[model samples]
Target: MANHRAAWTDERAEQVIGELLRVGVILSVVVILIGAVFYFLHHPAARANYRTFHSEPDDLRSIARIAAGAVKLRPREFIQFGLLLLLFTPVARVAFSVFAFAAERDRTYVIVTLIVLGILISSIVGHI
Candidate 1:
């Protein structure tokens, strides 16, 4: 009975994790699409200035700027925010996995997950 219960718990955890990932990806795509729509609506005549390949403008560089721009319904910021969400999805997944492993009293897995989470977060902020 204990074995069966553990198996059931594991299966449920996997399902929940899978759902989390699917939802995250779908939400990211939706937000990005909405941003694209806003961009096209506001910049109907703007051409792709990809030849220069310059960095995004100051307003699109930082999260603070992006959030402020998003409040003003700026499409580039919306797209940038969406991209941020996309970037954080896997980090969120690892975060969830850490909690899930802790809940299961799986100390080894929990530690490993925490290490992975730490590395991921470090990578994100390492440059800063």
Candidate 2:
């Protein structure tokens, strides 16, 4: 256990976090694309009505509802969930930074990274 912990160096942590970001983005894209395909499949010949402005459905007004819609494979909600995932990718990196710093016994960095993580979360949650 100690040997494995020692092997988890800064470079390794960075590489893992980088991969997290890349995979997150790729997964978001795949989700969005899948939703788009589903949307088109259901509305192959549908055309946009430009006569009046339309708002998003009431069911997509909250994260819980969006998640529920996504679980049910609703197209717009699924795409919105994908976009929400993309938005949180960087936030996840910052959160991992706190863990990495804690593992290294770097209190200063852990504190700073925690502040950054808090701000990121608040900024996202405040408007919601």
Candidate 3:
């Protein structure tokens, strides 16, 4: 009975993780679409200038600033933030896995997941 319960718990954790990823993707897409709607509505006359590209301002480059801009209803910034969310989904999954492993008392996986998470965080932060 104890062994069956353990297996069931592990299965449940995997299911939850899968669901989390699916929901994250869907939410990110919805946010991106909302941003797109705002962007087009606000700038009906503006056309894309992909041939002559210019980088976004420094303020919009950072996550903190992007979030602030989104809160202020800046469509472009909100789009960027949505992209940021898409990028962060995997990281969130890893973080969640670390906690799940810890809960399961799987020391090796917990340590390994933590290492992956640290590396992931450093890579993102290093650019900033």
Candidate 4:
């Protein structure tokens, strides 16, 4: 583990985190764009009405169903998955912060980041 710790120098961790954010955002945009293109292709003249409000479909509410749909190349699911990825990107960064702090041997920051991570997770899963 000495070698692993050595590899996670502060600069290295920052660079990786920066790259991770960049890649995550770009991938999310690309996925959302692809999903949009497919959606428009399938529904050239589709329109939404502001006169009514509707909740998300039951099938699309859960992660398992979303993954299943996205895997099947469903356009809406792709869009949803992209949005999910976008939302998860920050959560992931916070999670990595715990490791980054631990690698730097900063116990206080590690604990703080863990608390933040826990809060993020609870907020995400709390409504369920």
lDDT of 1 at 11: 69
Q: Which regions of candidate 3 are displaced past 4 Å?
A: 1-8, 126-128
lDDT of 2 by residue, 31-120 (tens): 999999999998899998888868777777677888889999998899898988898899888988888888777899989999999888
Tens-place lDDT digits, model 3, residues 1-128: 66843553567788988998998888889989999999999999997678876887876888888998999989999888888888998999899888788778899999999999999999878455
Q: What is the C-alpha RMSD of each candidate to the true structure, in Å?
A: 3.3, 2.4, 3.0, 2.3
- What's each prediction's TM-score? 0.85, 0.85, 0.86, 0.86
Model 1 pairs whose backbones collide: none
The lDDT per prediction is 0.84, 0.87, 0.86, 0.86
Clashes of 4: 0
Q: Which stretches of candidate 1 lie over 4 Å from their true place?
A: 1-8, 126-128
Candidate 4's residue-wise lDDT over 1-128, tens digit each? 65887677779889989998998999999999999998899888999776877888855677677778889889898888888889889999999889999988989999999999998898868333
TM-score of 1: 0.85
